[model samples]
Target: MSVFTLTKEHLDVLEEKKLKSNLKLIEKIIRNDDFYSMDQKDMQYFLRVADVLYRYGKAIISDKEYDDKEIWYKENHPESHLYDVVQSDLRESGKTVKLPKKMLSTDKAYSKKEIEKWLDRILNTALNLNIDRDEIIIRVTPKLDGYAAYDDGSTLYTRGDGVNGQDITRAFKRGLKVTKSGKRGLGAGEIVINKKYFDKNLSEYFENSRNIQAAIIAEKNVDDKVKKAINDGACVFYPFSLIDNWTGHYKELLNDFDNIIEKIWNAVDYDVDGVILEAVDSQIKDNLGSTRKFHRWQIAFKRNDEAAEVEVVSVTPQTSRTGRVTPVAELVPTRISGATISRATVHHYKMVKSTGVGPGALLQVVRSGLVIPKIEKVIKPVEPQIPEYCPSCQSHLIWESDHLVCPNKSDCPAQTENTLVHFFKTLGNNDGFGPKNIEKLANLGVKHIHQVYDLKSHQFAMYGFGEKTSKNLYDQLQASQNIEIEDWRFLSAFGVSRLGGGNCEKLLQHYSLDNLFGASVEDIEKLDGFAKVSAEAIVEGLANIREEFFKVYNLGFNLSITPKLSEQQDSSSPIAGAIIVFTGTMLQGKRGDMEKHAKSLGAKVAKSVTGKTTYLVAGTKVGENKINGAKENGVKVLSEQEYLDLIAQ
Candidate 1:
């Protein structure tokens, strides 16, 4: 079989655009089936041409393949203007008109770390605005995979190029109903067909729903199958506001991120690419505005879990900074998503031993929304290859639970180098203290982080750095100390076992940095969220790093102190510690603003009323049944004005 093929329909569409030359290049790429060798110009052209073909319902490749190439192109060329504009739909004939509102593309996030970074910006902005941290609400909705459209009451327009769109009002005339009997004028939405309906009724006649969508709005007469699908109410336009969604505080959103994502991903029957996350507060959204390409307040999390089975070449044991020996499986070079995969880490030596992950064993590797691949399952077994000694220092290894540990922490070259690297990396302000330089310094008798910081320009030159490089390195160390960083981040740089930035921030909320080191295990265990075992580990870890921490702390680094929770308490407020649920259309201001205000007045804002809820503040349009339900649950019901009056007093 050929490596890839373009359908006759796809070729005809390309030929209509006078893209015969582009088609020759595309055909050559298909025959080659190698994206690595494609030049930048060729890659960009292929993407544009592929986009046009896909929009016209004559796709030349699967969505995953196209998305992979797009991601690869973006990573390689971030400055390209190709992604700045929305992908245009080139219908054969239509007089384009300006859309009622601009339809910008969503900014994409691939991992939880990126999402957290996005949320951090929101939190920081809220802090600057004096908004309560608990008041920020995040909304998650499924990102529909369908033809993009805009319905402004009367006209149904395509998202042609985000600014101007073609009027496809003939779609409504052809009996395309709003999804769930939802009314028009709901703004931005997508034209989608129900998955089950399409599979059961239209799949045999039409290749896919995209083809049917294209036919529904064809300048020519609509196809019989497409018309029937629309008439049967199986296909409709779904507005963004009418979709099923999950809403909660930022903490609950992050704490149950996986479950929320799963729940919203399958909430609708339409095809979903991912989930959309955005801050619901108008103040926060307005403060965090938009770029030309997309809104800063909104991000789409695309989960790409592509798996490929490949044979393992070998298993190698590498020691981490914490002296935990990790089993890394070297694999026969394979492509799982867009990136090449040569190695993946086994969870531990136990997995390697039990699963027999050795040379020539077949394993399934999945790129689960990550740059790095992970072993999903073992397909074929072979004799296990477990290491008895550390590869770097030749230290005797001991089994600690499921992991092998190298006990030579005081002198293990790998451990010392990795620890030094982690410290500088976590500091995130300096550039010259990477692994190569740290490893070079380690070889030259520099064993600790303090020793690296203590090196002078002449000492660095003596340690084998060039004259200019030595001066730059010394200056960077001084700069790293002077830049103001968060205390939690600084504490996290020490690489304690149970103290990441989140836990560090939590600990610092109750205790000052000066007093944290002196806290006992019992003291730490008393704090919320810290278990006894975690407290014990944290106490031991603090003791181990106490002396070195003070040495670095005394180095005169500028640090921003974390705010104390006690300082934010408003105990004098009437609703202090009261759980309040606000609902319906607010009159005095936005519902979000009211929630924020209530939180600032020391009330605990919740999305729904429960038995423990102190009050259900109802605004205009709230149902009587909902009010009675709260009252039946032993909750006080208050009108918007009544609640405001109480808070005022």
Candidate 2:
């Protein structure tokens, strides 16, 4: 398929000779480097350059290439700006037209995993807001691939840069009819022609619909074919709402991901790159809210459109400060995005061995939206190279799963340094514990977390740190402790195996900091979102950290306690602190009303029954599953009359 390309004049207009030269450099580098392979950096740069051209009405790649490959790139580098940028609009026409309404980019999901995560979030939000899960409805529609414009009866404005857009009323003036029989000013819409119409009628005259679209909105006279196409009723403005869609409750959707996608994908006459899925309730949408770029309640899933294959030049093992010999692929320098990348990480020697990620191996790499390109798939296999010794300490290595482990855990200088660095980084509210200072301190025998904290302002100057730096370090330490950090963050600073920030927060929310020291593996697993394996690891890890953990805990750090169910159990109300489960249908009120009443009484009404369930209330037509689940879990299953009677008493 024909794709857009850049001209010397366009490049010159942007004063982007460096980018042009870099593309040549990338091309030259690819010849030397293995094709089907690239470091994250090269893939990243290539994506930026390619996308920049795409935004300028001169895409250098096809939709397929851009989607698949670029999807790979974005998946790898989610933190990249391209992953975060509002891609639906590419700063249309450089004119920021005031929108009739704020047309926020929909929250996006690329895979079912993310979609499920979204579902969970919606469920959690319902629980928080005291709403019934069954009542939560979601709407899925085709995300039209065309110029985004908003209409307010009189004016049509491009969704230009989100806030301001260009006046594109000319398309309407040029006889663009509304889809369906809807009147003018139906909010957001896209300028589109029927795919069948484009192929049948306009294929001979225009290269692509996108090019033809540009011409239709131009200030100049429209082409005869375009005019004829317009007269033919093939081209029209399709409003987003008027687009066909699928709507259902969460469970139905959870069971049928493909059916939902395929139906929405084939819904519209316009070209669609992805599906737009969002919760339909205004309350949920408001609670979820939008970020600076997109709505949190909704998302448009767009796979990337760029990918390339390059060879893995070689796997070079380098020791981390932790003494783990990470395998880095030193590729022949290639350009991706705006940078020159000669190296990309291969993660570990295990990946090198299992996936045949080695010299002469062809690897498919893609730039993540705006993130560093990452190795996605190995297209060709090669002999693996496993390092037997730690690259830093030269200690004998051991196997940890697929990883060739550096067994020098305790005294390994790399591990010690990294551990110290992790400590300071996790503290979060401090400066001067960054790599440069920590490296200097570690070199001077400051290996432990307490040892670093014990240093005086004057002692830092003795370590050759400037006096100013030393005082700042002292102040940062003081400030870190003074800040009212959550108890979980304090524990997370230790970097326990299963105690990342999120887990720490989750655990703390269920139990007090002091109580956690006494928590068993079983106790931890009882909490929601925790599995037995992770709980076991956390229990063991916390045991190891208890000695050191208390030492730090005693340092007068400001820690806030996480409230608990037991503490709030007695409010003299009907449902406070009770683990209530609702079942069957109700007549006095909708199931929604009963759930809300329980929440108002401060009760934890869970979706599923468990051993800890305080009361399971049955209404009418209560299923055997509800009864069996409550009985199996050892919960008190009560009839609607019995539950009401108990609550009254």
For the record, the alpha-carbon RMSD of candidate 1 to the native fold, in angstroms, is 15.1
Model 2 Cα displacement at 349 (Å)? 7.8
TM-score of 2: 0.50
lDDT by residue (tens digit), candidate 2, 1-649: 0112345644752354245646553343332322123444456666655555555445554343555456655654343556434243444445555686877766666678888998888888888888999899989899987767899999888776666688878888898888887889899988887899999888887666876766767777998888887888877888887989899988888798888888888887788879988889888877776654567778776565444676778888765553356687766565555444556667567788889988888877665333334576789999888888777667666554445545443345657776677777767678678877777888888877777778899998999989898899888988888887667668877756557666786787677788887999789889988888677667755665576667777888987654454554357786678999888887677775676567556777665555567989888998774586466456788888787776777
- Those runs of model 2 whose alpha carbons end farther than 4 Å from true positions after fitting are 1-48, 60-90, 302-649
Where model 1 places Cα greater than 4 Å from the true spot, the runs are 24-33, 58-79, 84-92, 312-649
Task: Score every model by TM-score.
Answer: 0.49, 0.50
Candidate 2 lDDT at 526 equals 90
The TM-score obtained by model 1 is 0.49
User: Which candidate ranks first by lDDT, i.e. highest?
Assistant: 1
